[model samples]
Target: MNKAKNVTISVYSILLFSIALYTLATLIYSLIPNIPVNKLFAMIVAFTILYLYIQRITLERIIILLFCLFFSIYTTIISEYSSDNINDLLWIVTTVLIIGIASDQKFRSGLEQAIKRNKKWMKMIIIVIELILLMAVITPSSYGNDVGWGKDASYFVGFATHSHTLASACCLLIVLIMTVYKDKKISLMEYAYYILPIYSILFSGARTFLISVLILIMINVYMKKNSKLMRNMTLLVILSSFIFALFNSSMISKFEFTSNNVYAKNMLDSITNGRSEFWKYDLDLFFNSNFFIQLFGRGFEYIYNYNYLKVGIKIWAHNDIINNLISIGLIGTLGYVYIWFKYINNFFKRPRIDFSKVQFIIFMLFTLYIVAPMLLNGLYQYQHYIFSSVLLGQLISQRD
Candidate 1:
């Protein structure tokens, strides 16, 4: 039994390491411009690692697998055999399978232990890579989105595919730091390391990422130091004030705020950053669809094509709920919500009054890093989802 447990730990550690390697390869590919095989090679490797463990199944795993199988067949029957559809189908299969494996109690237990054993180096390596990526900000991407709408490439994409990607990656890295450190006090220098990722998110021009990370930090600190209520509250208040001032500062003000860009003509547009328009479109499609489409929904490729045709540009509903409604339909969305309910229930079933526990910390991190971003930015297909699935699994594995 001990040998089996050790073997489980070792295998999980290898899987985590494989994911880290894939992420590193992605970062390198971003830096080196035209790599021969490209980032897909790394993604394929990571997926292959997870795919090999598919035989480790449970009732939940079977349901998730069936969900994927149903959608694949439904898509094939209804949609054309286009590359976009095929790629979307593959992505759905991969994501659900990852979540399925993560939902397994045994797998989650092994992975949680693996993360605990290796988190120190994991935190250090991720922060170092984050710093490296930040330095690359000076060398702008050839096609970085111009927040000014035509003025210049002011958004700091750094070495990422987009500004949002860099910001999102930084948020995930911060989660790693929180998970490893837990409620432990650290030196001033270690605290300063937190600023590096925060700064990266600020410059990346992802408004949602910035807000979410700040909230995450405050919540994390508050939970850990809640015993000293007054002191921690004071600290969080001061931190919030500083962040508010930083946004209003002259330096940050120079770059046009994403919401204040030329595209936003009115108050509602500015507040939503034009996402309301996309959401409205998606909602209309959902409401107007026939029974079959409403029940199973059109696939993501269909949404992409629909958006392109209607708007003359490719745009997704930035919100996941709406995105899922139109892309996967009511039944599929309900299935997804069911999975979320199960995982969420698992996390909260045995809440520790001492929120500093690693399981609780991981739950918070997953909520902030994965759930929030996916809901706000339609990041269901984000690269970080791979790693976040492990976090989700870890959260679900907790029994007490």
Candidate 2:
């Protein structure tokens, strides 16, 4: 019985790891266009099978799942179905369910142990992802020419939907690698590995990610021992300067301020870009709506409809918090905020001495990743939510 149970656990571990890698890889592989449909179907099937085989149906899990289901159904009923809204709704439901499963104490422990036990494999996976991004940078054929919302250039999209997505993925991967090897002494080669994703972020021209990485590096320098921290910081500065020189034109263009007003220009030069106008419009719409719409949102379709008709631009709210308030309403937004607060609070309550330098770095980066986007970019991307779910699972499992 013991042997059989061990074998089952091992199989589930492999399945879970494969799903995570596949989800990440699809960011690049999705450039093929037709492959995403099949890939997504396969991922859903695998996840369902894994959940059924490994997870025990408990009251808590059931309640959480039901809550997700209810929200999904509510969203569907309140709004007319469009492909984008349907996709967003599906992603939310899937993410909530995964988080629910991951919150299971036993499953979280098992998953964390499995990851630790297979560090070598995890390292290989990270390296592979880095290589994919590198390849995307070197070969123009790997990325599409359509500039979704970012500037048009030979920017590296890697396997992501856009340059920003690629930058976000690289940033997240850097934090994950740091978390995985937080205690171990990293060698020169490993440092080079870290540079790969940093360069990818630079080449992708993601200012938000660049700012976030710089903040993270500064935090590391402050938190670590004097000599070693200075050495690492100096190395990072040198590497960053080299990359910036290589992509001077792109960097300059991104930083160029078009506004004449000093404060507006400064704000635009920062991560806000043109998002302030969008946010203002969204806020106006939300406020002017009826009581029901204000309380429970006007749905995803409402945003596009309002924008196209009034603002002359067919775009969703670029801010996540605003978007959530506009789409899911006050109830859903409050619930989401409550869960986020609980997770962050729980994480800090853990003993400070128990965390390594890298772990602390991960915590800071994750916090920035979650918070930064709420002000500028919407977190409608399923892959990002899925990644967050896994990270939260690992963090929660650390509780004794």
Candidate 3:
């Protein structure tokens, strides 16, 4: 019996190492400009999971994981018929493992210990940042006239693929430093940290990214208001946003490079850049399937592979809600709501932990996710995935 238990622990320990590797690799990816980022990251995480199975699986965690697996399976089934084959249902499985690990007391202790050791590591991180900045400063290519990626109005920026993500990270980091860094009062540097991401998101110019972040900024400030400056900043953002809307057509005209081709703005006329019309047509392809599919789904095979060869539009629904409805029906929507509410309930019930600014900032990032741009479109996925994961981590870990 003891040997069996030892074997179980060993399995889980390996799995834990995988998770740790994933987290570390993710941090590096967040910092670096470009690499074989996402696919490699996923592979590393999967290997980590294999290592983690050394520990005996808790029955509670198993139940949680099963719930996710079934949920994903059901999504595949729906998409099989509806043809809205989205892989988001995989989030359930991922969430179960992430939350289960986060729930562990030892994990929480390790996090606290890391924070304590930050003085030693933080110096290295600072040096690295300074070195990176210096490289950018010295590189002759940095200031050169840019290649236009085959279009006239194309402008390149420093951010890698996930601008919204970087923006959200900056936002959260600023808030954390502002609120949680013990004994540090607000200063010019801190103020810049707070505001830079919000500015960066606006400049990112992805409609989904911009709207989602703005909405969250509004809500977060409303909840954690402490000064007239924040209140004024919020008001100015609203005014500027309204002006931006009125000048939307001009903004389109100004970006002549994107204006000429596949990326041109249609004034948000059709939600998926006319893909919704295709989806409306594709929904007919299901051919009157009954009962289970109408309720849960047909399966994953249909969503990713099916094609509307005749029409120019062949891609899937860019809207999350519509996609969920097609794949999981009303039940999936309810499940999502339950998940959100579950976190909210947990947030309210947990004893106070003084995370200060970071808490509010991270919380706001979550708000931006649902209420803002994510609601509008699905183009900015990598941002959502990471931000959402961190939010989940904070909730389950009950971190301060």
Each model's lDDT comes to 0.62, 0.60, 0.44
Candidate 3: regions farther than 4 A off? 1-60, 70-92, 95-152, 155-185, 194-200, 215-289, 304-314, 327-337, 348-368, 383-385, 388-400
Clashes of each: 0, 3, 29
Give each model a TM-score. 0.81, 0.79, 0.58
Q: What is the lDDT of residue 203 in candidate 1?
A: 61
For each candidate in turn, give its C-alpha RMSD to the true structure in angstroms. Answer: 4.2, 4.6, 7.6
Better of 1 and 3 by TM-score: 1
What's the true lDDT of residue 202 in model 1?
66
Model 1, span 98-214: residue lDDT tens: 654555566666777878899877876776676676567445452355544334535556666666666656655655665566545533544566675676666656666755666
Best by lDDT: 1
lDDT of 1 at 68: 77
Candidate 2 C-alpha lDDT tens digits along 1-400: 9986676568556644665465466556665776674256436634664464345766766766666667778788888879767766765555555544544456666666666777787787787777776776677664554653334545566766777766656655765665455444434554576777777666665666666556544433333334676657665875577566646635444555323323243465344665676677788877888888777786666777776675566777776678778887877677666555565555555554477665566566556656675566665453543454365437433522
Query: Which residue pairs in candidate 1 have backbone atoms (N, alpha carbon, C) closer than 3 angstroms, thus clashing?
Result: none
Give the alpha carbon lDDT tens digit for every residue of 1-400 in model 3: 9885555444444433333333333334535646645446455544444244334376755655566668766555444444233434443344334534543554444444444444344334333433442443344432221433233332212233343343443333333332223234333443343343444444334445445445444434444334758566755875576457524422233234333334323643333444444455446544355766556654544444543452544444455444544555556545544554464444434567565565665565554555443345542234334433443344324443
lDDT of 2 at 273: 60
Reference-based lDDT, residue 335, model 1: 76
Worst 10 residues of 2 by lDDT: 257-266
